[model samples]
Target: MRLHILGICGTFMGGVAALARELGDVVEGSDANVYPPMSTQLEALGISLKQDYRAEHLQPAPDLVVVGNAMVRGNPAVEYMLDRQLRYISGPQWLGEKLLADREVLAVAGTHGKTTTTSLLAHLLESAGLAPGFLVGGVPGNFGVSARLGQGRHFVIEADEYDTAFFDKRSKFVHYRPRIAILNNLEYDHADIFPDVAAIQRQFHHLVRTVPGNGRLIVNAHDAYLAEVLAMGCWTPVETFGIGQGDWRATLVEADGSVFTVHRGDELIGEVSWPLLGNHSVMNALAALAAAVAAGADPRVLLPAFATFESVKRRMEVVGEIGGVRVYDDFAHHPTAIAATLAGLRAKVGKARILVALEPRSNSMRLGAHAQALAPSLADADAVIFLHRPELPWDARHVTDALNGRGTTAASVDALIASLRDQAQAGDHVVFMSNGGFEGAPRRFVDALRP
Candidate 1:
């Protein structure tokens, strides 16, 4: 089968393209901005990629078009597909019909930590010799690739809550129908598609409704929004995990937040000593462990794998160090994510100066929906810098004003880099936070910091 994917450079779409190729299909794809690691990974897989979406790019007429969620009505390829009445399907729908339909799908869903938790679960399964297939949003350092077609009965996926396609308003996870679903946590995000938290909750409820009565739903016990979602309806047996509560819980064993002791109710399961920093990571570990156990892996044996679990890329990833100054990259755009990333870094570095560079690139941030919460989220950072882009809907001046001298705003990437070079001292840890590449500012800062 010849499949042409639109907006295929995105993490999820790129993974789909790779999986299609792995499944013995000839794959070609087009996207507006084709940069990598995703582009590089696709090339490594021998997949052909075209730069921007053009109607002519579809001249060969693929047997099927896999549309990405990023694509909309105005995309030339989408319009061409519609005009020609060509057969097309959303990426998630394609994966559901082709890959997930027959497998025991272990899906990780939440506004945050989906990628990390999914990768961790996949790794645990692999450690248990399950060799499960997986499609994660970010590249797990352990896996090397973001997507794989393993020969196991289980398929682990980073189930996103984003809308499937322009034609499909339902969340992407709705198509998954996971046998083992992990609702990591619930929070307001993606302001572009969702009107508010309640609207997002409705979509999550849709996901909960799909789980089979025999399957398991692993959730965060402390999240009130998740409670509300479950109240809407849940047919599956549920297992909860939190810091000090839930059927599964993690007790912090170390002050630096690196070591944790896992417990099943009052019974001690085991301890996990890893370099992972923050309570969020601990919760992610707990969630992953619960889902793995639900998938039939013995909890007692899988606990030690957590110690060797490498984190996903761009989640507090230390890119390089120069002049004793460390530069890190994180895919944190929302207030909650930002807070977690910084708090984790704080726990790891202690009293060291932590400088945060943020680009409000996500749709919610661009619209200034979480503007009021932005400043407080960066409270842990010793100094905060906002990369201001005029093309976005909201003004960065408002964010700077909210910081009240605690933060500074930069109109361009160069300005931001210069500010960091001047303000960042030898003992400082500078973290670049954005969903997008932030105009390559993170790598640029690492290079600039070199002697």
Candidate 2:
């Protein structure tokens, strides 16, 4: 089959392209924004890529077009495809109907932690000799690739709650009928499509309804929003996980979340001493462990896998460290995620100065939905340089003013990197936070700091 994908550079859509190519199909794609590591990964697969969605790129009309959620009706390729009456399907729908029909799907869903949790779960199942097929939003350091068709029955996926496509308004996860689902945590996000927290919760409930009675639900005990989702109605047997409470629990062995001991309802499973940091990381560990056991792996056997677990790329990835200064590239745009990541880093660095270079790249951030909470979330940072581009609709002054002299605004990525270089000194941790590529600012700053 010959397939042309719209918006194929996105992490999720790119994974779909990879899977299609691996299935022996001729794959080609176009996108407005093309940056690494997704772009680099696609090129390595020998798949043809176009810079933007031009009508000509769809020439001769492929056998099928996989439409990404990012593609709207007004896009040139979309308009051309519709005018020609070409056969098309949303990415999620195609994935659900094609590859996932026969696999034992183990899906990880939430507002945050989906990528990391999914990667970890696949790693655990792989270590247990399951050799599970998997698709992650970001490349897992353990596997070096985002999606693969493995030789085992289990297929682990990072199930996102975003809309499927311009034509399909329902959340994407509803199409994935997983036997094992993890409700890691829930919060109000994606301000572009969702009106409020209640609206988002309704979509989560739809996903819950799809799980069979024989399947298992691994939920977060601390999130009331998720509890409400379950309360709406649950048919599957549910197991909860938290730091101190739940069917599965963890006791912190170190303050930075790097070391922890696992417990499964009064029986000590084992200790986890890994490189991850933050209480959120511990919560992710517990959730993955429970889901792995539900998939028939022994809990005790999976403990050692945690110690050797290599996390997903760009989730606190260290790009460079030079002249006693460490630079990190992190994908944290939401307020809750930003706070959790900073808190973990603070615990790890002790009293070292933590400087943040932030870009409000997500739709929620650009629309000013999270502006009020931004200041308080950055409480862990000693100073912050916020990128306030001219095209952004919202003013960032409200957030900067709330920082009380700790925050300032930058007009561009170059200016932001320059500001950080002048302010940073020896023994400081510099973090660049954004969901998008931020024009490669993180590495640019590292280069500027070089001798």
Candidate 3:
């Protein structure tokens, strides 16, 4: 089958394209914004990629059109497809109907940590000889490719709460129908789509409704929003995980979250010392472990895999360390995730200066939904450079002012990098945080730091 995917540069859509190509389908795609890891992966697969959503790209009309959530009604390609009455389906629906139907699907879903948890779960299962197929949101360091069709019957996916497409308002995870689902943690996000936290929880409950009675739900024990979600209604067996609470627990052996001991109820599983930092990461590890056990992998066998597990790209990825200064590229847009990441780094570095280069790029951030909480989230950072682009509809000064003399605003990526370089010192850790391609600011800053 020949398939044309719209907005294929997105991580999830790109994974779908990779799976389609692996299934012997002729896959070609187009996107308005194409960059980095996802684009690189697609190129390596030898799939054809066209820039932008021009109507000309869909002229020949492939066997089917897989529309990404980013696609809207007014997009040139979308309008053309609709006018011609071309057969079309959302990426999530296509993936569910075609690839995941026969597999023992294990879905990792939440507002955060979904990528890492999904990657870790797949890795644990793979290490234990399960050979599970997976479609991670980012390029996991352990597996260079984001998606694959494995020999085993299990398929692990990073399930998202985002709507399937402009045409399909239902959350993407509703279509996955996984036997094992992890509700990592939930908070208010995606301000463009969801009106409030309760609305998002409603969608999560929809996903909950799809899991069979025999399936299992791996939940965060400390997350009040998720607890409320379960209160809505639950049919599957529930297993919770947290640092000091829940069915599966972790004890912080290291303040930076690099080392932790796992517990499954009264029984001690083992200690896991890994490179990932932050309490959020520990929670992710515990969730993955519980989910793996649910899928029939022994915890003892999976413990060793943690030592070798490499996290997904751009999730606190160290791009460079030069002249005693370490630079990290992170995909953290929400206030909660930002605070957790900074706190972990603060613990690791002690009194060392921590500088942050933040880009308010996500739909929520750009819309000023998280403005009031942004400054408080950066409390751990010694100094911060916020990229306050003119196109952003909100006044960034509100956030900067609340930083208590620690925050400064830059109008462009270049300015942001320069400000960080000026403030950075030896033994300092500089983190670049954003969900989108911040105009290649992270690597550019690393290059600038090169004396």
Q: How many clashing residue pairs are found in candidate 1?
A: 0
- Model 2 off-target regions past 4 Å? none
Separate clash counts for every candidate: 0, 0, 0
lDDT by residue for model 1 over 1-451, one digit each (tens)?
A: 9999998999999999999999999999999889989999999999999999999889879999999988889778889999999889999999999999999999999999999999999999999999999999989999999999999999999999999999998999999989999999998888888888999999999999999999999999999999999999889999999999999988898865699898998899988888788898899999999999888899988978887889999998999899999999999889988998788888778899999999988888988989989988988888889988668767777777777687888889999999999998888999999999788888999899888
Q: What is the C-alpha RMSD of each candidate to the true structure, in Å?
A: 1.0, 0.7, 0.9
lDDT of 1 at 19: 96
Tens-digit per-residue lDDT, 105-179, candidate 3: 999999999999999999999999999999999998888999999999999999999999999999999999999
Q: How does each model score on TM-score?
A: 0.98, 0.99, 0.99
Show the colliding residue pairs in model 3: none
Best by lDDT: 2
lDDT of 2 by residue, 226-332 (tens): 99999999999999999999999999999999999888899999999999999999999999999999999999999999888999888999999989999999999
Each model's lDDT comes to 0.91, 0.95, 0.93
In model 2, the worst 10-residue window by lDDT is: 32-41
Candidate 2 differs from the real structure by a C-alpha RMSD in angstroms, to one decimal, of: 0.7
Which residue pairs in candidate 1 have backbone atoms (N, alpha carbon, C) closer than 3 angstroms, thus clashing? none
Residue pairs in clash, model 2: none
162: Cα error in model 1, Å: 0.6
